[model samples]
Target: MSRAEETADTAAAWIIRRENGDWSDEDQAALDAWLAASDGNKAAYWRLKHSWKEADRIGALGIAAVPTAPRKALARYGMPVALAASLVAAFWIGAIPFLSEPSAPKLVASTYKAGIGERKDVALADGSHVELNTRSVIRAASTSGHRDIWLDEGEAYFEVKHDPRRPFVVHAGARTVTVLGTKFSVRRDGGDVSVSVLEGRVRIDENPAKDGRPASTTTITGGMSAISEGRSTLVTQRSEERVESALAWRDGMLSFDRTTLADAAAEFNRYHRRPVIVTDPGAAGIRIGGTFQASNVEAFARLLRDAYGLHVEIAPDAIKISSQGVTAL
Candidate 1:
């Protein structure tokens, strides 16, 4: 394949991967990097995406193939409505009556998104405040006496104003968190959502499957956390100090209490473009703890080299970490 064709195929693969499954933080980061690499990649991906959606609608409407000059007419008709007319003229007229437009979503929510290494503080019209973490997206709207937020990806801290008439609900993946007036932080990674309450109380509802069965709900008070992933939901209580530690990012710091090197690398990668890749399993599992600026990956790498006798290789694309003897590829 030509270079352009190869890039187009790569873009198409990324689009397919995102559409077929839950895209995690790593996938998002890689996609962001690929898009940033070239403008042609972005155009090709979007074109393929639009084509796929159009193909889905055409297939669903059962638009059969046209014969002879009708095929030429069908090709000439560019718009969907014109194509529908051509298909109807070629086939049975009653088939057109069976086609219906796709149903629109019930809520018309406003979306707020934060780019990589960027944090956003958004104030809702309803007196609620939200602090969106890097590379996060949330859709919020108030209707039918309910204030709902859908955390599509990444983390957000919410400070909800008291309103008994309007219950605040946050839908993240398979879990839903309901609060009245509370300060809470929610982190969504892939199919999991971690909720940490700082003030007041909130109830979390979890649905393991989409079978319409009753969802399990649990109430979490201040200094409590709940993690919902797939079929399991775990709730735990943390000390006030720990709760403060978890919210350290609000103050432009990342506090890690004996965090694994691999985990620490992942955390730091969330804030910056150059990923810290730990090559060796032993080096990756090494525990380190301290408060550090989220953007200072070089300092973190230096710390690993000086304190733990690890090898740090600074490359153009990534910061590779490994043991002293292990060679970094």
Candidate 2:
């Protein structure tokens, strides 16, 4: 097939996925790649997308008109859009709209994806250790003088061997995290992306050239972490060992050093089916500290219940948490 045909096919697939509201990471990446390949591709995709959204609006209007026979004419207009959207992507997982467009043309672009409940480790040519966790995708290549990886989604732990000339940079949405030689994990969870350092130090900054945002910076040392909305963190310069508690899950152990119960429970949810949901927002910041073996996170809940007098109730599809005893703030 011609490149345009292949591109159109890919775009059509993406449109169908989004219209169905079941767009997956794979489909979204394909659409992003197609857009970055040429402005023409983006224009085509957006054109279809606009048409589809308009169709959805029409469908909603038609649904409202069903009770009002006087509004039946709007129903016909809605049918075409509904049909197009059905062929587009209205029922599948919604397409993520955060893909980045490149600044200039390039010869080749790479793609990487990880499945659910999966873990992978790799040693780069420069002696860097890359550990990719479940359901993550990242792509990287060196073109000019810089080395970088675009993390489409999920988390990755990187132990970058020192290279002064070619510093390692990780790209997640609008953020670009840089490291000379260090051990760190970058996790892109929904809108809250986090970076935790285990060894050496790394710099976190915005990529203005890509997103045109003012540059903000942070330096994370071993056992330190920073979290941001999308990519801006309200917290930073934390203790390094504390960051270890969060990263220890990769090693099959859970560690906590003066972390709050709410934070610990959130970590537990990462590995549990029924996530721990804090009923009381006040409990989210309660102070707690200790080293507990990384086994079933349920054990941690029981420990809290027994020792701290907290109420633990397990629902059919979820775990609910609430304070039982009067506790000091």
Candidate 3:
């Protein structure tokens, strides 16, 4: 078989395995690495995945079905022979055409989002990388000479490819962050925005003035952060450890250093539909420190119960915590 055919088959195998209900983070990482290896691989995977979804819909509609063959005869890498045959047939029949080198690069508008308890990695057409945090959304668009991103909500870490001709700009809340090439994260909570730079530099410009006051611009480099609240923007230098802790969500963990129980609960709530609520002011004021799995609300609650001698009431809708002997409401 040709190299293209081999790649297509591998892509199909990946799609089937992903839908098998046991896909893990390691499997996702492997798939991401494969897709990032080449544009052809990424295109092939997306195209085939789209076709597979269409095939599923058609099957659900009771349409004429693709012929089934014995698994041993055509199965490749555990893929169902009928499905594999359908994919190949689709390519040949022009339902999903085989990809070829384009005459010119196409700039496609795309949106990347992650639901609660989920994270997503997006490889952009320009070689940049974006990792969306839980409950986050971002819209990305590119033109021949420019690239733009709007952080509609939540947070995302960006590894931008250096392109002098195409300025990469991210709009979040009332601020705009521009970078030629850099590694950074932008988070939006309502009208507030925060930017943390891990490498290189970025420029943050406040949006046009609405109160007849002049807007401001700030430039921050590696190990620095900028926060905007209302009309004020504050830039501060951060320790390397603090920077790493801030980005821990990308690794599915939450790192807290002397973080308050209330604040920690808020952080955990972003990844869980069921919230962790500290019932009393005393428990809310209690400071704790650790790195915990973001999705493991039960584990964190257990820690509060065991280590802090706190009362933990685990209901179907929420986890309530308070000082020992204090009933959680």
- Which of the numbered candidates is closest to the native, going by highest lDDT? 3
For model 2, the run of ten residues with the poorest summed lDDT:
65-74
Predicted candidate 3, C-alpha RMSD:
14.4
The local distance difference test score of each candidate is 0.75, 0.64, 0.79
lDDT preference between candidates 1 and 3, better one:
3
The C-alpha TM-scores of every prediction are 0.67, 0.58, 0.65
> What's the ranking of the predictions by lDDT, best on top?
3, 1, 2
Ten-residue stretch with the least lDDT total in model 3: 65-74
Model 1 residue 81 CA deviation (Å) reads 28
Residues 98-176 of candidate 1: C-alpha lDDT, one tens digit per residue: 2232442234467799999899999998999999998898978786588989887899999999999999999887688
Please tell me which model should have the higher lDDT, number 2 or number 3.
3
lDDT of each residue in 79-142, candidate 2, tens digit only: 2434543323321112223123445434244556656545677665556778887667777565
Q: Choose 1 or 3, whichever is better by TM-score.
A: 1
